[model samples]
Target: MTLLYIHIPFCDSKCHYCSFNSYVDKFELKSAYMEALKLQLQADLGRFEIGPGDILSVFIGGGTPSTIDPALYEPIFKELWPYLQKGAEITTEANPNSATSSWLCGMKALGVNRISFGVQSFFDDKLKLLGRAHRAKDAIDAVENAKNAGFERISVDLIYATSLDTPKRVEAEIAMAHKLPITHLSAYELIIEEGTPFEKSPNVKKESIEQSRRVIQSAKDAGLEQYEISNFGDPCRHNVGYWEYRPYLGIGSGAVGRIEKERHYPHGILEEYIENPHFKKIETLTDEEILEEKIFLGLRSDVGVDEKILPAQMLQRAYLLAKEGKLRTREGGFYNPDYLLSDEIALFMLG
Candidate 1:
């Protein structure tokens, strides 16, 4: 019941709203990085004594993993291929501009089953404003290439905020997404992360709450249902493990893994290569903490907490919300509201 994540910390360029631990340079060290990752995996398995179990999922996220030549990926895949069982989910994050026909086909042949593209916006203006290197056309082309190459599960990541983002714009974006051959969609609200250029811009959407709601409604209309507060997909299996708080492993530079015994594993640097991979920290969530997390995350999805186990206080809150026509019980649990931003108001009200 563990998940493995590999973080490729190199990218061709950094986006304006990005706060993740990724950089635009140091891809030259990818070969060394791969060697270190292999050593790290071997050492980790030894320390953990992970049995010959299914590799539940492998996620290779990046500054830009697609930018690295597939030849460098060969060794890592060779070592990992042995551990994979049938139905194991493997996902990679690729930038639209970096994705091409050849790259998609090569990874698929190697059993890479899923791809999540970074397609922030369809409008060229939004793309430029976000500092994305790919235009909407590139996104269209990438998804088509992936489908033609036999990828069955594809997810696209989008961002919303700023002056140009309106309910109409959000609807339009989702409408455009419907034309593409993708199975999943993960849309996020704009957050002015620290040290990013957007933090200094006065044009940032401080009060775009209404606009956010419209955007989400647009997505639902397109049949991309909301599974979590920020993420939307089929929803993808990777997200199920994540939202359900299932166990997983994290590898590569700056990657984080939460294992048993309250331990976390991280690959510290993209600059230096190591024969053996190690972690910077392992965080433990207390019993109370895990309970709280379940409530927080569960409430964000369309299917909220099971009524049987829901806290008495939460049930009371739900009662009040239902009375107000803001919450409704369904087959799984409870739905907050039909609107997109309802989750936010629900969280605040319930909190």
Candidate 2:
């Protein structure tokens, strides 16, 4: 089966810790950028036409997709809605600051069924530290508005590792996330990317994985099952495609397609993506690589994997980790119960 992704590259303000293919040109460039995207999509349609066995999952990801002028949406939706599969999963990535009830209503009217809100933190001070534009109140209010606008499936995002982000604080965020109406939560640790402004700053990478583990466990304690290293949900669909090694097509700037993907990189995903939209350096994986990825991704999830598919070496290590309660295996393969500890375990195993 095949899936689709559409990247949206606009944010109300640049976060101090972001290094994606986004610009601060919010005024003059917004309209023109949308036009450019339309041109690109028009030029790309022939090569990516729909076929049988396709599962359409259009994700409007971003610098911040919700910040875009809603005016740009209708024309594109009109042009492309004809080809969508009957039970398609159409989602949009939105920042809390831009997710107003009217905006969500318009999106629902235009066929968006899923909404993923970028709510880095529910504490005002932590929000400021992450350079987020919205207050915690805005996030709570946005989710409420999204529900009122008829969104049946909603996802929320949280950043785990940050200064002042104690295990207790992370646990508190988990408690808050559980109480909210969102069905999915992508709770990720803050990693400082090279060349991002925060990378040069001293405190951006201050939190440890050991401390973060407590917070992730706190989420599990709150009923949000860890489905992947950074994602959690019930009946997760979008991310499962990635972990389970399903085919997908990604469009727009900085997005990567895995319909046919190579494990090795071209050093810079953004540079190559802008220069060549063929998912430059893309390769259809060999069976071996696909199997390796399946074990790797499954081990990171609470769902675990099938025993026969796991490599012998990975199985041995999984047993050792399981004895320590760091990982567990059932009739299925293995899973990192405290997935927040996964990074350190991977590093140690690799070393």
Q: Write the per-residue lDDT of candidate 2 for residues 1-351, one digit (tens) a residue.
A: 566667777677888778777655644556655665565555545555655435556778877788776778877777567656777788898988888888899899989899999998999998898888999999999998999889989888998788778767888888898788989888887888888778878585667757666765776787776667777777456667666666666666656666554432221333334444443455668876776566566657655556676567755766777788877667666666666566566544333
lDDT (tens digit, per residue) of candidate 1 on 211-324? 667766776778777667666557667667766677667777677676643647564656543534664566777865665565565667654656655567867876777787
Candidate with the greatest TM-score versus the true structure: 1
How many residue pairs in model 1 have overlapping backbones?
6
The whole-model lDDT of each prediction reads 0.75, 0.72
Clashes of each: 6, 1
| Candidate 1 wrongly placed segments (more than 4 Å) | 261-267, 272-276, 306-351
Q: TM-score for every candidate vs. truth?
A: 0.88, 0.82
Q: Candidate 1 — which pairs collide?
A: 3-248, 3-249, 36-274, 40-277, 264-282, 266-279
